[model samples]
Every structure is written in C-alpha cells, then in structure tokens.
Target: MSDVDVIVIGSGPQGLAAATSLACEGLTVLVLEKADHLGGAVVSAEATLPGFVHDLYAMSMNLFVGSAFYEKHRVELQENGLEFVVSAHPYASAFPDGTSLKVSTDEGDTLKMWRAHSSADAEGWQRLGQLYDDFTQVYFPVYSSPLPSKSIASAFRGLWKVRATTPPAQLLQLVLSSTRSFGDRYFTTPEAKSLAAAWGMHLDFAPDIASGALFPLLELYGNMRSGMSIVKGGAGKLPAAMARMIEVRGGEVRVGAEVVQIQTDGRKATGVQLSNGEVIRAQRGILTTTPLPNLVNSLLSKQSVPSKMAEAARTYGFGPGTFMIHLALKGPIPWLDQELSDVCYVHLAPYVDDLARTYQQAVAGILPDEPLVVVGQPSVIDPSRVPNPNQHTAWLEVRAVPSEILGDAGGDLSEISWDEARDIFAERIIDKIERYAPGFREQILAQVAFSPVDLERVNPNLVGGDSVSGSHHQQQLFGFRPSWSLNRYATPVNGLFIAGAGTWPGAGVNCVSGPLAAERLLRDTHPSKRAFRRSR
Candidate 1:
C-alpha cells in the first residue's frame, strides 16, 4: 500500500506552503529536508553573537506580507506563533558624492527627503509613490497569481484593469520602455533615477536589462505599503510558522532524509529510495521540489522521461550564482549621511554601467573588481538582532561573484582553495563598503562568506548556487519553465512530479510553486478517491 497521500521534499517556503495546502485537504503528508533545521534559504541565526539574531539570507518579507497569503492567513498564522515587525524606513542608498536618500513610511516625508536633493524630484517622487500605490492595489497581484502565460497580452490586460486610474501614456511608457534606463528616464537627476533603479535590480542580477523596468514598481510599492519587515525571530521564522501549521494538521517533516533515487518500475515511480537504504512508498507520488534535469540525469531511469523533455531540461538555463557575506560587526557602521542612520536596505552601485558590468563579470568567471552590492542592516529594523547593545550584525549580498571562482581551476589565473576565494571576496566587499561608510572596515568583529560553491554545498537544488532555481527570462517563463509540457508539475512517470523555485513564477519567498503543485495533486488525486469508493 502507498505510504502517505503526498510527500514534500525540502522545507523552504515552497515546501511548507505545499505541506500546508495538502494538509488542509485532509491528506496525510510528509515533508523532508536535508538541512538540520527547517526554512531552506530563509533562515535566521546568531551568526554574529548570542541574542543578536541575524537573518541568514533575506531580511525582508515585504513581498510575502503584501501578498494574498498574508491577507488570508495573517490571523491564523499569528495564533500559531507567527509575528512580524515592520520598520519605519525601508531603505537608504548612498552615491559616491556623499549624498544619500532614505525612504520613509510617510509619502510626504519621503518626498521631503527627495526634495533635499532636487526640487523637481519632489514632484517626480510623488508620482513614483502613486505608481507603487496603484501597483500594490493592482499589478503585484497579477504577477503573484497563477495567471497562465506571462505573455504581453496578459500583461496588457492586467494593465488595463488599472489603466483607467493611471496616466495611460506615462504608464505605457513606464511598462514598455522601463528597460532603456530607469535612472535616465522620469527624474531629471541621477539621485532620483538611482533611487528608483534600486527597486528594479532586486530580481537577482537584473542589471540594466530591458524587461525589468516594471520591477521598480514592485520595490516602490513594497517600501510604501509595508516597509521592510522582519519576522519576529528571523527570516527562518516565516518558514517555521508554515511548517508548524502543517504539523498541527498532522503532517510530518523529515530532515536529513535525502531521497537518492526514484524507485520506478518500467513505467511508473512506486516510491523513493533514501540515501540510508530505506524506501518510502508514495501512493500519490508528488515532488514539491525537484530539479528536473538533475532528476532525469541521476534519479529517474532513462526511459521514463521522453528524450525531448530531457533535452528541454538539459537546455533550461538558471540565472547567475549568488554570493553572500555574513558579518558580526564590532560596532554599527558609521555613515557619512545621517539620513542613512536607520536604513534597512542599501544598494552599492553608482552608475548603471557599473551595475550591469557586475552581472557581466559574474556570468563570465571573473570576480568583479568592484561589485554591485546589496546590504541589509536588519538590526536597524529589528534591534533584537544581537545581544551587545553597541554591536550588531549585517548581511551583504554581492551579485558579482562568478560560479567558477570557487573551483580549483576552470578559467583565468589559477585555481584557489574555497577558503582563500571566500576571504578574497570578503576583503574586496568590505573595502567597497568602507568607501561609503568610511570606518566600516574597522568595525568588523567577525565575518563569514559564502560563494556560489558554498551555496551549492548546502542545497543541490540551488544548482551552481543560483538563488532563483532558474532564470525568468521570456524564454523560460510559464509553460517553458523546466519544460513546456511538464508545466502541470506532473512528470512522465505516473506518480512522480516536480516542484521548486525551478518551476513557474520562478523563485522568491512566494509559495507559488507549492500551492500550484498542491492544486494539481488534488485534482489528480480526486479520480483515485472515487475509484477507491467504488472498490469498497
């Protein structure tokens, strides 16, 4: 007999959501994760010092909170131990000239902040706020939803729903021409454009890409509506809440129980073989987080997946690898601009070309001479980060490190040890931060760094250390994600399916993959339930 109704692998945001959705249907479910603790990428820890909880990866859950998930489950989750803290100021960014901009919760206050830089920008800033306000109420939902096809047709229709309220010509220009240069258009000054550009580049190495112009709208909306939010304990707390919810419904979570192989019998997968010589049968086989090509090449029998599907999986491209630095600072970073004092989010890229070059270097195997860095000072938003009053920890996401930089030898110069590579990357990043925050380097109490190689070491699903699982380019979106025909999460194997950030609405803390997989599983399982009733 089958072991359970469904089994979800990984306890990332996606996995937890899948478990929760399936559990709600009264299906017996199990979730397995390799990490000792739950929450894959969204984890928190005392990496810096005791009592000072540091967000392991991302500090902001504004996107998740602004989403329908929070709207529907906020009260339910809070009762189950989920709590969040929102900061008044979302972000602060500094240019080389010693000027900085801070985004405040109040629109007028934010406009005043911009007014200090440019009078015209004060008006432009107001327009920008309106854009995000409209977006929060409209555009974001469409992108977050399981709307079929991210086609221009879908985009335009989504736009039409809000078009009557927005300035048609301006909105159309922003949507279609957002790629030309977010900083060059709209505001006459670089300060305004760069501030706006900050929102666009969060899509992990977006650079100066064309289609991303609309992304700034998301950033603006997030900052305006919720500011950056810190889960009560840490980023991991969010996933932990989801896991708890699932468990409360009688679901099980297994950690360090890796599924090494799919036990298939010629045409269908009957169960999964664990690395430790045990097998778990799946009466209703489903994988809430499976990397297709990796599965086809390693776990599944060659005959199971069609040659074309295998080819597609092999050809599917994941975006650039993510390199991060976690630091336990000796003291808070002293900033030149007082406005940056309470800032939670900071981006370090002066010119658009410099930012694009970071991506170019990353794609090519070269460590950026000067990388575009994303720094999150969660302690500023959540004072409970560290035990020491004077000291706090910070996380920096350097988007410029190449995937090959961690290897012994692949390209330029010679191969270096992982330790050496991490140290070298950390030194360079700290030096860059010192440029803006002059005494920053001196404040380092302790620091740890992770290259794409280090990220891959932790989660194989994050192939080559890519955070997005796969790229969301026009060619890879929707049905084309992982593979076109395999869009429903079902594989050629009868009971097996694929799920993860590698699927549609590619990557993020969003539960799109999990809920979508659960929905498909529910639909597929209904037939079996009816047949079982007939048999009885």
Candidate 2:
C-alpha cells in the first residue's frame, strides 16, 4: 500500500539532509525536487564563462561542518566527493579609508589583527573566545537536536555553569544585546566594531536589533575556532554529496518531479500528488521544505491549516532581497590594499552607520546607496574556480537590496525595471569596490548581474528575493519559527512534517533543521527505537 517510509519534498540543503538522515536510518526514503537539478539555491554553473564556476547562493557550511548530524555522516559525504578548501585569512571588512580588519583561523594572528585597532579589543576578543566556548557547550546541542527534555536539560546544565561565574544582568545582556550595542561596549576602535556589525547582517539582523549579538559572537569567534571552507570545486558539491549518500543507501532522489498537493485523509497525510499527475504513497510521513505560504496555499487546501497557523503563515515577515554580481575575471581583483586579495570573504561597508542605513532603506523597498556587499573570491581559496591558475572568478552578494525594481532609496536612480536597473546598480556596486581596489572593474572578462527578480526565478523559496526564506525577527524565531503551532517540524496534520530555513535554528545552508525534523519523525514512527536513541 506504500512505496517509501518517508518522502521529502524539495532538494535544498535542509531537505537533502533530512532525506539522507531518513535513508541512513534504514527507512525507505524518496526525495522529489521540482527543478531539473537537485540542489535548490546551492546550484553552481559557469554563468559568466566556461571554466568559471559561481554559486548562486554562497551559504557557508561551517554549521554543517560542526553539526552532530554531519559528524555521524561525515565519511559518507566525503566519500561522495565532498571536500572543503579553507582560507588562511577567513574573512574581513574594509572601510573606504583603505584600512581592513581581517580574521584568521590562528588565534594569535586574529588577536594581533584586533590588537592593531585596540589593545582593549584584543583582550575583548580573548574574552569573547571564552564566552563562545561556553555558549557552544550549551546552545549547539539545542541547535542541533530536537527540542526534547534531554536536549533542554543539556542547555540548562551549560547555562547553570555560566550563571555560577557571570552576573545575572551581564548574562541577560549577553543573551539579548544588539550587535551595535555590544560592539560599542567592548571595542573602542571602528575596525573591531565593523567586524561585529558586518557579520550580523549575514542574517536579517541590522546592528541595533536585539539578539543580533548572538550571530556575530557565534559567527566571528566560532568561525575563528572552526575555520570556514568552500567546496573543493563549487558549493554544489554539498548537495551532490547528499544525493549520492541517499542513492548509495538504495534511496531515490528524483528531480523534475513537482509536488503539487499533500494528500490528507481528514486527519493524516497519506501521500503527495505531483504536478505530472503521479502519486507516491508514503507508509509513514511526508516532509516538506516549501516556503510557509506555498505550503499552506498550494500544497494544502484552504482551511486545512488551523486559522492561527494560516494567519501566522500569511503574516510571516520576509526579509529584504539580495542583488548579486558574478564575474569571470581576466586576473585577480587588483586591490589597493594587497592584504585584501588573500581573504576569502570581504564586507564592503564604508562605516557601521552606512550598513544600518542600508538595511533600513531596503526594508522600505528601495535600493541602498552604499549597500553592504559581501565580495567573495572563492578562487582565493580554491584555484579550481578559474580556467588558469592566474585567472580568477568571483561573486558578490549585495544584501538588503529591495526586491522590487524601484528607484534607489537615496533618490540617485529613477528606473523601475530590474532589467534596466540591475546593470546600473551593478555599476554603483563596482564603483564602491573600485574605491577600495582601484583596478577592480577592469579585471572582469565577463560579468552578470542578478536583480531580486532573477533570484526568485532561480529559487522560488527566496520569495521576493528574501534569501533566508523568511525574516528572523524575534516573534518569528526559535520555538515560534514558521509558526508557534508548527514549531518542531511536525505540522497539525499527523504524518506531516517540515524543515529548512522556514523552521527553527532558521537560515543558512546549515543542516540544523533537517536532522532535527528527521530525529522527530524517526522517533514518531519507531517508538521502540526512540528509547534506544534516548539511552544513547
């Protein structure tokens, strides 16, 4: 009566991770991807020119690298050709003054980088490193596992240790502080401050938002401890590895199969109806990674989801859109500051204030005058991205850009079409970069610009080009992610579950949500195994 134990819809990072987990558990797993390719936004291509590889979305896999789920499956993924290329100088943020603050995997090098800006900040970095160690011991388990009592107990145990030493008020401040406030309190120089603010915007958080400090602390210090790395060839290798894992385990990963409907029988989901009119019945459950709106409207019928859940999905706050520029360079980006050429990821923000204003303007539905652009030269880390060792290819993601092709927020441009606007906006982005790296624009052999609309065309989950699926605002985060009712991946409908950026532990190519959902689903279907897992 049933074909597979679990049918995972979509082949995004989280979806693939979920399906892989299910398959590894010896459950019959089937992964359906609507697109021709398996990886969703993580796809790569020679969009600029032949021998030039570019990632549509450059999601850092540090979370995946550190995840407990990934550790369990590391050998399988690596065996399937998943290899990471690390940068000695991991990340940096540059000011127009030609000064750059860089972070290195070597603690001494990173401390020296901060010490140049402020001696106090160097000490602060050491303190932050200590705090990061403490936070990781407590929260990472919670971030990795299902929200069970044992997991919660681990979090409490870690918190109790911190409480014994640190004051309650300072601990609360550490928990709830904003990046801007946290930076201001700890570091006196703009260099150290800019580093904190730059990392915060990687999520939807602007510098001054509450709990925004968590990301910077986690990103900067944690990445320092656990260096960031790109896939050996391209970011696409990650999903390819996941698919390979499922296939080798005798599970099916089918592309070009669009899931049109979730077939529910009054109280439980039975199967999925594809757009091609084929029905695949599941013995146990259906796991979806679609955006909240599409899940409630397109997949499920009207009034199927409870009113509160439907309202929550309807009112889900999508974050600002992104604009990206891809280039196949004749040679490396000629930088005025030669130190910048070695760093893998660089944040091009004139000042911390400019970064904040850019976010504000994008939220108001307009392009930022000086956008916070993350210029990534993956070739710096992996030379395989170029045709020759001397030549290079790179991509830059301009975050918090308006999804709509309206005029610039600063009233600098007037065109209303993305086709007309993308090039001009790209020019502005190039101009900003050229200010720091003089011959930057001339290094391009071929260049392509993607407006917000172009992003949506590639990945529908990036609705209105909001790449993180939906916003990470306080009301819509953690236990209240997606919705308060649909929290732990399991929906109101029995035998139905969800995962991906739309769920808890929120955004990034991080495989957090997938395994979390898989663990829950595994426990639900095999109650006997649940006690066995709990015992472990």
Candidate 3:
C-alpha cells in the first residue's frame, strides 16, 4: 500500500481547499509546501512594523464567502478559528479634487449618491444592477461548475430560460464587451463609469480589453449586495483554519517540504520527490497547484508528457506585473473626503482613459507616469490587526507594472533593476495618494514595498508578479484555461491533476479550483466511475 491515498503539493487556498475536502471524505491525504509558512499567497506578516499585521498578497474575502467550499464547510472552518469582518461600503473611487463615489448595500442611498452626479446616471445604475442580477444567474452556476461538463451545459440551459429578459445575442455581446464600452453603454458621468471600470484592473483587464466587462459588473454588483469581507485577524488565519480541519480529519499538512519532482510510473503519477531527496508515495494520485510552466518544465519528466501539451504549458501567458506597498500608519489615512475612510477599498485611478494608458504602458515594458493605486483599508472594518486602537495598516496594490523594466514613461528610473527602483516607484505611489490626501506622508510610521520581482520570489506561482496567476483573457479562460485538453482539472498523466488561479474560473479568493480538482479526483477514483473520465 502507498504511504498516503493522495499527496497535494502547495498550501495555497486552492491546495488547502482540495486537501481539506479530500480529508473530510475520509481519504488519507498529505499536503506539502516549499515555504516554511503554510499559506502560499494568502499570508500575513508584520512587514512594516511590529504589531501591525499586513496581508502579504490577497486580502478581500468576498469571493471566498461566496464559494461552495465555504458553504459546505463554514461551520467546521469557523470552529477551526475562521472568522470574517464585513463592510457595508465595499469599495469606492477617490478623485484628485477630493470628490468620491461608492457602492453601498443600501440601494436607496447608492441611487441618491449617483443622482447627485446625474439623474440619468442614477437610472443607468439601476438598469446595470438589473443586468447584473440577470447575468449572474448564468454566471455563478457556469463559474462554479467544471468547464465543458454536464453542469456547464445545464447552466447554458438556464441562460436560455432568461432569454426573454436578456436575449442570447445581448448576453453574448455583454460577455465580449470591453469595460470601457460597458461603462459608456451604461452610465453618463466619468465618475459613474470609472466606479465600475476600475475593478477590471483587479484582474489583468484594462478598460479597453475585450471580455473584461463581466469582472467589473460582478464585483460592483456583487459587493453592493454582499459587501466586502476580510478575515477577522489576518489572511493567514484562513489557511491555518483549513490545516486544522485537515488534521482533525486525519490528514497531514507540512511546511518546508519542497516537492521537486513527480515520480511517475510510465503515464501515472505515483508520488512526489522532495528537494530533500525524500519520496512520499501516493496510492491514488498527486494534485499540484503550481503554475503550468513549472509543472510541465521542471516537475514532470519530459518523456511522460506529450510534446504538444508541454508546449502549451510552456507558452502559457502571464499578465503585467503588480507592486505592493504596506504601511504601518500612526493613524488612519486622512482622506480629504473622510467618507472614504469607512470604505474597505478605494481606487485612486480617476479615469478609464488613464487606466488604458497605464495598462498599455506596462504591457510595452514602460513604467507608467501614473499607475492605478488600489488602497485597501482593512482596519476600517477589522481593528484586531493593530496593536492600539489609534494605529492602522494600509495595503496598497500598485497595478500594471512590468516584470522586466525596459524604459520609464516618467523618464526618471530607466535601465535600473527592480531592486534599485522598488523604493523609488513606491514613492511615486505615495505621491499619487498624497495628491488626494495631503499630509499622507506624515501619517506613515513605517512602510514596506514589494516589487514584481519580490512578489515572484515570495510565491513562484505569481510569475511576473501577475497576482491573478495567469491572464484571464477569453482564449485562456473556461475550457481553454491552461489548455483545451487539461481544462477539467485532470492531466495527460493519470492521477496527476492541476489547479490554481491558472485554472478555470480563474483568480481571486474564489476558492473553487481546489474543490473542483478534488471532486474530479473523487469521481475518477470511484470503482464504477472510471468509464466517465475524459480521455487524456
């Protein structure tokens, strides 16, 4: 008999979710992580100063709260010490002139805010909200179900049911529309348009990118209904809770165990070989949450994978990089519009055209003069993260940066390595914030910056510092994610599954990939279910 029924590599949310699911099913499972810490991108640390906790990468729990895994295991996970803090004002945008707009759960108040901009915009906002409601009935089911599966087919049938309200052609157009087009079609004012368009940058979607409308619509409407949530203390508590859940179910989670290779038996994954030269056998299978390139190039022997599939993995695309700045503040950010202090997140990009320019600049390997700065204020909702009541932590996400610096659009930091230029770029982000909130620099008790390169160093899956793992462009999403053949979370090699932000329904804290992968494995392992497995 093998040492364990299955061995899962990586302890990211996806991996942990998969392991926990399998463990709950009474299977013997083991999770291995390369880093000394367990959580992959969802880690928390005192990066800026002592007693100030910062979420190293991911912060928003909006997607997690809406996931099936959370629904099934909510009580158990909470019993294992998972808790969430939510905000009524999920997100907002701050203009340079000290004006702002936000999406609130109270529809009346939100409409009132939009009416202040334009009555036409208020009507437009309600119409968009209706569109959101109509689209999500199809979107959520299709997203949660495995791509190209019976469930996906059923989801389309459900879409067919809504055709009287939202025609198939209209829905298809909306799906393919750019954020800019969507904004123009819906709202009149730039403030109203940008309030939705800014969310596209959360993924790799620029305002003008095709197939980008869905994200902004989903985020804006979804957050308005559900609000934004964060882990009670820090993001690390999530993985810790998951690990406890796995352990209670007789599974094991180990840190500092770097999986170096998949020990294969011709076409089947037998086990994983660690960097320490230790091989742990998996009787049933091995699931990997590593990026596609690493999986195809480094872990598996070249002979075990078909040349075409290997090529696809090697050519898997990653989007523009991201830079992060975490601040330990003497107090909350003194926004000129103090109303922003209560909101969970504020986007500092005021115009969709500006977002387009910055995105194009980053793609062309130029450091933009003005980048989109996403300011996350977790302390606004959760106070347990700080040592004192007066102190606070700020999470700044600098989007659309180049992984390799070629030139600077600003023309000041050209030809320098990221190591030398990280702080300088961070200064530009602070300066951008200072424009909206004067004396912002004075509130900074301490600050730490993570360049794109630094992000990749911390998590290899975040290649090029593309925080969403890989680009979610139409060609690489849904059934074509990673590749057409590997879309079902199964692989060319039997018993070797792959899942992560790089898989279907890509990115965010939407802990779906892991559970989907586990579900696939479970179905494949059943004695009478083998015939149903898709051909590799």
Candidate 4:
C-alpha cells in the first residue's frame, strides 16, 4: 500500500502551500522536512541573543500577504492564528549627503517626498503609478499563474489596450527595458532613480539587464498602494500556520525525515527513500521542493533524466549570495533624519551606479566595498521581536556577495574565504550603517553574522547561498526557469515533479510555485477535478 497520496519534500512557504492546498483538495499528504525544525527559510531564530528573534532569510511578507494563495486562504489562515503587522512607511533610501527619499503608504505623502527631491520625478512617480494600474489586472494573474496559462491571453489584451497605436517591437522594448534605462526615462532626480534601481538587487538583477525594471516598479507600486507587512510574532508563524491548516485538513508534516533518494523504475518514480533507509511511497505523486540539481542528480539515478536535461540542471545559474547580520540593540538606530527611525525598511546604497557595481563585483567574484544593503527594523513596527520594551532589534543584509570569494573589491582585504570574509564584510556593512545612523555600532548588544556559506549550510535549497534560488537574468527567466523542459513543474520521469523558487515566478515568500504546481498537477492528472474547480 502507498504511504500517502502525495509526498512533499521540503517545508518552505511553497512546499507548505502546495501540501495544504492538496490536502484541502482531499488528498492524503505527507510533508517531509530535512531540518529538525520546519518552515525552511521563512523561520525565525535567536541568532544573536537568547531573547532576540531574527528572521533567517526572508522577512517582509509584502509578497506573501499579497499573494493569490494568501488571498484565497486568508480567512482560513486567520482562523488558525496567522497575524501580520504593517508600517505606514514602506521603505526609504538614505544618501551620504544626509538626504533620503521615503515611500509612504499614503500616496500624497510619497509624492511630497519625491517633490522635495524633484517635481519632474514626482510627476514621473504619478505617471508610473497610473501605468501600473492599467497593467495590474493582467500582470498579477499572469505572474502568479503558470506560463502558457489562460491569463497570458488576457495580459496580451491588456497590453494591446494600453499601447494600441505603438508598434509591437517598441512595446516589447518598453516592457523589457532595464531598471537604469527606465529610471533615466522616468525620473529627473538621482534619488528616485537610485531607490528604484536598488530594488533590482532583491531579484539578483543588475541595473542594465533586460526585464529588470519589473521588480523595482512592482515594489514601488505595491508598497505605495499598501505598505509592506511583517509577520506578527515571527516569520516562522506563517509556515507554522500553514502546517496547522494542513494538519487540521488531515495532512501530516514530518521534520528530521531527510529524503535521500527517489526510488524509481525505468519510466516512473515509485517513492522516496529517507536517510535512515526508510522508504515512503506516494500513491498520487511526489512534489520535490529541493533544488532540481538534487532531484535530478542525487535522488534520481542515471538515465532517469536525459543527459542534456541533467546538464541544464547542473548549469542552473544561482546568483550572488547574501551576507545577513542580525543585532540585538539597546535602542533605535540613530538616523540623521529622525523620520527614518519610524520606517522599518531602508536601502543604503549611494547611487544606481553603485548598486550596479555591487552586482558586477559579485559576478566577478569580488567582495563589494559598499555592497547594496537592506536594513529591516521590524521591532519598530512590532516590538515583539525583542524581549523587553526597552530593547530594539536590527536586521541587516548585504546583498550580491560572491558565493566563492575570489578577491575583495575594496582592495583592503584578501584571503578569499567566507569563513574569514564573514566578519570583515559585516564590519564594513556596520561601518556604512554607522556613517548614516550615528551610535549604530554602540547600540549593538550582541550581533550574529551569517555568511553565504552559513546560509547554504542551514538550507540546502539555498544552494551556494543564493536567496532567490536562481539568477533572474534573461536566459533563466519566466518560461525558461530551471529549464524549458522543467518549466511546467513536470519532469521526464512520471509521478516526479519539481517545485520551488527555482520554478516560474522565481523566488520570494510569494508561495506561487507550489500552488501553480498543485493546479497544474490537478489539470494534468485529474481532469474531472480541474473542471469542478473551474465550475466552482
């Protein structure tokens, strides 16, 4: 007899979403997590001090709470105790000149901030917001759904309506322009341009890359509409609630049950083998949430995946790793602009060119002198992160760090090893923060620095420590994600599927990949069920 109807391998947001969705569809689901604790990268831990909780990787739920999965299941999840907290100010960018640009939840306030910098950029922001509204109906659905999906036609229609008289090539170029190019066209101020450009680093997109404008634009639009949110107690609460939903719906979640291999026949996968030699068979199918490389190269034996397909999986481009630092502070960050203390999210990069150079340095295997930094002060919005009311917390991340450090971009440091580079880089990042937030270094009671290697060690899925799963460059995006063959979450081997950040819609806590995989699985395997879903 089969062990379960379906087996999900990994407990990341995507894996949890898929498992719960499948269980709600009345399938017997078993979720196996390699870690001792569940919630993969979304979980929070006391990395610095005993009472200070820190988000391991992803912190903001702007994407997660805004996702279709969350939208569909909000009531059910809220019933199970999923709480979120949001700030009035979305994010800010601080410059060396003691001037900063802020994005507020209130549009007029945001416009005023832009106006203070440049009236032309203020107009540009309004124009961009209007343009975003035109594309919202079409873009959101298409992005959160499978490619060659029904929503693609609607997107085309929306696009044509927006650019009725424009030539198709010009329209394509407009949509596919780089972040820097778009900034140049839209904004007059370097402040606005740099703010938008800095956002590209989140998706591993450099300034001049094609299709790079989307992230910055999307972040601005969404945060402008509804301010960014954080999980109430901790980031772990999200997936823990998902686990609860799955259990109440009659699914099982197992931690410390490491899946070592996929036992398969010549044509199809039969079941998974645990590290301890325990075998669990899947009656319906298997959703492999680990990276495709592990799935194709380790789990499945040779000849299971085609040679070329295996090569593609091996060559799957994982971009720059992030160096994360969490601090248990005595008080708030002392920003020169006191208004910044109220904001939770801050991007610290001098200019768009500086952000671009960081990416370039990362790809060239050099440590950035001034890495594109994101500092999140969740305790400002929700004080539960710290133990006492008197205490504060800071979450700092230096993005686009080379996974394998070949040299230091600053030329002040050498000895290219993350073990050595971790502290040195963290010091540099804190030094940058100290420049803007005087007394920043003094406020730190205790600090924990996690190198790219540290991230990889904790989560195997974050291979080489790339938080985005894979690079968001043109060659590996959209339909070409993971690989063209594995685009639809299906593999050559029957009953074996891949789903995760490596899939379409890429990474983030958005929970798109899992649900998309679930929908496709139902469409392909249970036609009657798909029809029923459609009818409903």
The estimated TM-scores of all candidates read: 0.90, 0.95, 0.97, 0.95
Lowest lDDT block of 10, candidate 1: 406-415
**Candidate 2 clashing pairs, residues 3+ apart or interchain:** none
Error of 1 at 185 (Å): 2.2
| Per-candidate clash tally | 5, 0, 0, 0
- Candidate 3 per-residue lDDT, tens place, 501-530, comes to 999978987889999999899877764555
Model 1 segments more than 4 A misplaced: 133-138, 147-158, 165-180, 406-418, 528-536
lDDT (Cα, tens digit) per residue for candidate 4, span 370-472? 8888999998998888999978889888888888988897886775689977887889999999999888999999998999899988899887889888888
Q: Candidates sorted by lDDT, descending order?
A: 3, 4, 2, 1
Q: What's every prediction's RMSD, in angstroms?
A: 3.4, 3.2, 2.0, 3.3
Better of 3 and 4 by TM-score: 3
The global C-alpha lDDT for each of the candidates, from Candidate 1 onward, is: 0.72, 0.83, 0.90, 0.85
Model 4, C-alpha of 93: deviation from truth (Å):
0.3
Candidate 1 residue pairs that clash: 52-385, 52-386, 53-385, 289-499, 408-415
Name the runs in model 4 displaced over 4 angstroms. 164-171, 527-536
lDDT score of model 3?
Answer: 0.90
On lDDT, the stronger of 1 and 2 is: 2
